[model samples]
Target: MYIRDVTKVDIETVARISVEGWRHAYRGIIDDAVLDGRSVGEAARQWQEWLEDLVRRGDRLAVADDAGQVVGFASYGANRDQDNGFDAELYAIYVDPDRLGRGIGTALVRDMGRWLEAHGYEDVVVWCLKANPWCRFYGRSGARPVAQRIIEIGSRKLEEIGYGWHTMATLREE
Candidate 1:
């Protein structure tokens, strides 16, 4: 597997992974109707919009490619929360449902740190749904709980926990 900045050609596959991920990964936590209603075409449109913002904000989306398929992706950028002190934010990370547990997430997080560091960012924050099992992964990665807020989706309000590191060095693998 390899990680690289996304190109226009990758949007569709990335969208598919993201939509499928929300459907599979959040099955029990998120509203079933909400997840079931998401469409790849809509996701692709949203990604296109994010790509446009990426150019203007100097942010990026990177994808993990395995034998020509985009198995996972992560987006990072300047922190959007004005009250937060984090230098950057990991906006999202989603791996193909079928590809989980194979270290793809590890590779994606590693690459995210490298990319953010290269661009002069030090502190980083990532917000995960409180019920997401992957929250454990963030804890193991050295992210301390830094903040919390409620986000509403399809009539349901869920808590999101923000995790952060004062320095990316804490997130690097041994």
Candidate 2:
């Protein structure tokens, strides 16, 4: 497996994996219609726009590849949290359903943290659904839940938890 910066060529693959990962990971948690009607093409277009902006700004967008295929991807930048404490935020992290449990997610996050640290960020934060067990992975990776909120998407109100890692030292040690 190889991890590197995302390119325009990876947009479609990342979008597909993002859609599939959402469908599999949020099956019972979110509205079924949302996942069922997810448009990979729209996602790809959105990724293209995002990539263009990232390239212009020189921001970090990382992808994991196996056998030349993108299996996972993550995007990070300055903290978007309104409270504005952490230096960085993990905007998104999605792994192909077939690649789950293979440490791809972990590697993506660890690398995101490393990138943040290298770029002068003192802390990194990520938001996840409170009901998702993936929080365990974050906990094990040295991030602790620091905040919570209920966010409404469509007609559903979902619990969102924010996790923060103050430094990359713990991820590095792992």
Candidate 3:
């Protein structure tokens, strides 16, 4: 497996993986309609916007690939939440459902954290659905739940748990 920077050529693959990841990760936690009702076009548009934003801000976007196939992806930058109270934020981390447990997600996150630290960020934060298994992955990466908030996405409302790694040094300790 190889980790590399994301490019426009990888946008569609990222979108597909993101949709699959959401479907698997949000199962039982969110309404089936919301998950199944999501359109690839919508996801692609979101991916395009995200890529544009990353390019504009000069943030890091990394993908884990196996033989040129993207298995996982992550994005990190300065905290976007006005009240996140952290210097850096992991905007999204998603692995293809079929690629779970392969350590791709872990590597993607570690790379993002290191990128943030190298850019002078002292703290990093990530938010996941409170019931999502990915929360445990974040915990294993030395992130502690620091806050919680109710987020409304489409017609579904989710309780999101915010996890924070106060410093890159602490992440290495995990």
Candidate 4:
């Protein structure tokens, strides 16, 4: 598999990944009704706007392509909310539910770190629902718990944990 920048043709595929990833990974951690209500069309629309915005900001949106199939994707940019010493933020990352545990996420994250560092960003931050098992992935990627907050999703209040890397080198490490 290889990672590449997202293109307009990838919108539907990555949209599916985003919706499915949320439904599978956030099942117990988020409201059931919220997950069930997600539709690829809506996700694609949001992704369209987000993609345009990322380009406007000179940020990035990338996908993991496996034999022409998109299995995962990630986005990052100048930190929207500067905290600690981090100057960049990983906005989102989702592996196709069927592709989990195959190191796609690791590759995406490593690429993100490389891209950020090459752009002169020193550190990065990412946030996940506090109850998300995916936090384990962040921990494995050399991120430590650095911040926390409460966010409301579909009328439900959820706690989120922010993970941080003090140095981009941590992510570039093998």
- Give TM-scores for every candidate, taking all chains together and pairing residue i with residue i: 0.95, 0.94, 0.93, 0.97
What clash pairs does model 2 have?
none
RMSD in Å for all candidates: 1.1, 1.3, 1.5, 0.9
Instruction: State the C-alpha lDDT per candidate.
Output: 0.89, 0.85, 0.85, 0.93
Query: Which is the better candidate, 3 or 4, if ranked by TM-score?
Result: 4
The alpha-carbon deviation from the true structure for residue 18 of candidate 4, after best TM-score superposition, in angstroms, is 0.5
The ten-residue window of minimal lDDT in model 3 covers: 165-174
Candidate 2 at residue 114, lDDT?
Answer: 78
What local lDDT does model 4 show for residue 122?
Answer: 90
Residues 97-136, candidate 4: write the lDDT tens digits.
9979999999999999889988999989999998888889
Top-down TM-score ranking: 4, 1, 2, 3
Q: Tell me, by TM-score, which candidate is best.
A: 4
> Model 4 TM-score?
0.97
Candidate 2: deviation at residue 83, Å?
A: 1.3
Better of 1 and 4 by TM-score: 4
Error of 4 at 19 (Å): 0.4
lDDT of model number 1: 0.89
TM for candidate 2 is 0.94
Tens digit per residue, CA lDDT, model 2, 83-171:
94787888888889887889998898878877878888888888999988777888988988888889987579999999988777866
C-alpha RMSD (angstroms) for model 1: 1.1
